[model samples]
Target: MDAFIGAYLGVLTLPNVSDLDGELLIHVGVGRTVGIWRARHPGDARALFLFRSELGYHHHGVPRQKELLRGAFAGMHAHAHRWVYELDRTPAFYFDSITQLRMDRTSLG
Candidate 1:
């Protein structure tokens, strides 16, 4: 964690970041990660599509848009859009972890 933080802050001397295969949870509203991502992928239609898809996924089939949006984006350590790659094929892969995490957090609190 410290190494990744140092690398993100540009205060660490490290090799290629490409070798790191793990995911990093980032807050979209704060810090430089969003800017860095945008800068690195200017005019990328794929990124735009991904953002729209995530937005649509979380709010789809819901009438209470306000509450749904609040639950999706607010009161979390990491506030960002979450995308599950497989919606129809293998939803359990994503929801299982999501359920466990929510349960763990609720229990912890």
Candidate 2:
């Protein structure tokens, strides 16, 4: 964790970002829809969240109008932290951790 943080802060001696992965907080409009997912490549072994956006009947993989952060879209950590602050201010909605969606593959057939 420290190594990744150092790299992000540009304080590391070497730009060694091994094992560092970026994730996303997908939102369509406001409370209408929300979900989380990790960026993936086709050559990757598999994915934790095989996310696909649903627009009435249309389904898509990636989000449009993205604001890049850390070589990818903004991560879940930043979004989650902001959500906490907003909750404290307005207390409008509820949030929960859905940890059941493990990002690692542990099953074998």
lDDT of 1 by residue, 1-109 (tens): 1111111111111222222233333345322221112212232111111111122233233234323333443443332222211122221211100111123243554
Work out the TM-score per prediction.
0.18, 0.18
Which stretches of candidate 2 lie above 4 Å from their native place? 1-24, 27-76, 95-109
Cα misplacement distance, residue 41 of candidate 2 (Å): 35
In Å, residue 40's CA in model 1 sits off its true spot by 8.5
The TM-score obtained by model 2 is 0.18
**Which predicted model would earn the best lDDT?**
2
| Candidate 2 local lDDT, 1-109, one digit each (tens) | 1111111100001111222246534444222223333224422211112112222222222122111111222244454324222222331222211222334455775
| Model 2 accuracy (lDDT, Cα) | 0.25
Models, CA RMSD each: 15.2, 17.7
* Cα-based lDDT at residue 71, candidate 1: 43
